[model samples]
Target: MLREQGSAIRNTLDSVLSLSNQKAYPVWESVNSFALIKAAEAGLGITILPENLLLDSLLHKKLRLIELDGIDMENKMLAILHKDKNITQPLKIILDNISNVL
Candidate 1:
């Protein structure tokens, strides 16, 4: 399934799955994470999501993690800022907090 119409996830899947030569699977696309989880719980289909997002469901036994042997399913978070932009006090504080937590 897909999230938002122009999701980077779609491109990611295309690259990972060699989508050009493969037949398309039926998709249940949505922009909402809750909807996606509910659909998976109902056995509609499996989805790829960040481990953090699946913690609750996994703890409750509502979802299972299936590790694929050859898939590079790493997710990363990046913070970008323009070199010319000033780092305000508030922004620095926020960034520091996030850095500490991470």
Candidate 2:
């Protein structure tokens, strides 16, 4: 979840509440890379983490991480420009080249 603190907490709570009705489980919180590794080492909970976070040494043998498609946000690196500036020929060519890859 690409959410700020409060929203992340709410989402985690909702997941915990839903799981509670079916089985006994532990609920965790939204945490940065270091905190999450510590939580896992303490045997407190599991989390949905991105692949990039696992490169840290704390994550090694500490977290039981999994990958899920369609669970993460899709971010596009866009170039925002003012409409008033008339795009020069060189700029137009560059934009066209970027669009091709996208």
Candidate 3:
């Protein structure tokens, strides 16, 4: 998931380096957003993630952003529901919540 629509995350990092004229550095990868957030909040290291993932944390002053000037991107994800299966009220509510968040 670190790679956005098409390696956008990695591409974004490269672009940041190019723009800043900074030295190349290694980046740690995480399997999920929760892990990334936890590691970053624990002072492990900084990270670049979809802004939405860090919105609440930033609002509460739990995390900060390192601006990459001139960069603009949106990350998208898909959830598929089987058409053959009946969607119950609970499932509908869950799907609605997910939709609303995105």
Candidate 4:
């Protein structure tokens, strides 16, 4: 996955323009932190995000974050679910997986 850099991989027209020595488009402008994470999740590109954002069940299997040679931004993720819904056996398995991974 790519991060919010001027010369990273992106699929927008502005990103294309920037490659041709033209001005950048605001919609294609890259931001730091969660903006990169959100964009990656949306399939715009892959990225290397901090470990902390993957703490919740919603992200456990939905994405895969990679680590490189010397990165030091590991973190945790936290989430909350409804209390009234009956916890099913399959869901319990998913929760167990989340706990084991994070």
Candidate 5:
């Protein structure tokens, strides 16, 4: 499968693979989504991508959309901070609200 490396999605996929005890030997890996999609459409291999990214490509009769059962397709946003930084109650509340929406 084609994997977009160095992404949160890839990290999530790695977690899923670890939990499932499955290993993937990808023939292609890159950060370019367009190239990855093209490769998939060209029959290179399967790739996991957000539905919103597949809108135009799905219109092609030759391309098929396959859902990954039990997998969340939503993009997860992560916030990182320094170790010395303290999260105040207001900041925590705001972060919690934002996280809940995601």
Candidate 6:
């Protein structure tokens, strides 16, 4: 496994893999997305990353998507704020923009 350190997908990836019968593989973990992509391009191993991050490489055929059988690796972004906290005008506008875009 090629793992991205401190990535949100790490937890979900672990949970999904644990439920399967696949054997554990050695991991090359890094926090740098560029390094991860370089490693993958060099045929070191496969990794899971946001599609937007690798769009250019994918289009150039430098990397290819490896479909995982019976796995849903899709993820959604969530913006959380404390209910007790006050929402300032700027914050509200930012949140509204994000909500509208999404």
Would you list the clashing residue pairs of candidate 1?
Answer: none
Query: Candidate 2, which segments miss by more than 4 Å at Cα?
Result: 1-26, 57-59, 69-102
Cα deviation at 47, candidate 5, in Å, is 1.2
Stretches of candidate 5 above 4 Å error? 78-102
Question: For model 5, which pairs clash?
Answer: none
lDDT of 3 by residue, 1-102 (tens): 243323555566666667768734546655566777877888887777778889978998888888766666555567787889899999999989998988
Query: What does candidate 5's lDDT look like per residue over 1-102, in tens digits?
Result: 655656766766777777879865678787877888898889888887666567788987546898778866455578888889999999899989988755
CA displacement after TM-score superposition, residue 77 of candidate 2 (Å): 5.7
Judged by whole-model lDDT over C-alpha atoms, candidate 1 comes out at: 0.72
TM-score of each model, paired residue for residue: 0.73, 0.37, 0.56, 0.33, 0.64, 0.69
Per-residue lDDT of 1-102 in model 6, one digit per residue for the tens? 445534676766766777885543547777777788888889888878777778888999999987777788766788999989899999999999988765
Ranking by lDDT: 6, 5, 1, 3, 4, 2
The list of candidate 3 runs beyond 4 A from truth reads 1-25, 78-92
lDDT, residue 1, candidate 5: 60
Model 2 C-alpha lDDT versus the unseen true structure = 0.55
1 against 5, candidate with superior lDDT:
5
Q: Sorted by TM-score, highest first, which candidate order results?
A: 1, 6, 5, 3, 2, 4
lDDT per residue for candidate 2 within 7-49, as digits (tens), equals: 4433554455455464223354444545765665677656444
Candidate 4's displacement at residue 31, Å, is: 3.0
Name the top lDDT candidate. 6
User: lDDT tens string, model 4, 1-102?
Assistant: 443454323333335455557843343445565676667668776654445654452356666656554423433455567979788899889988999877
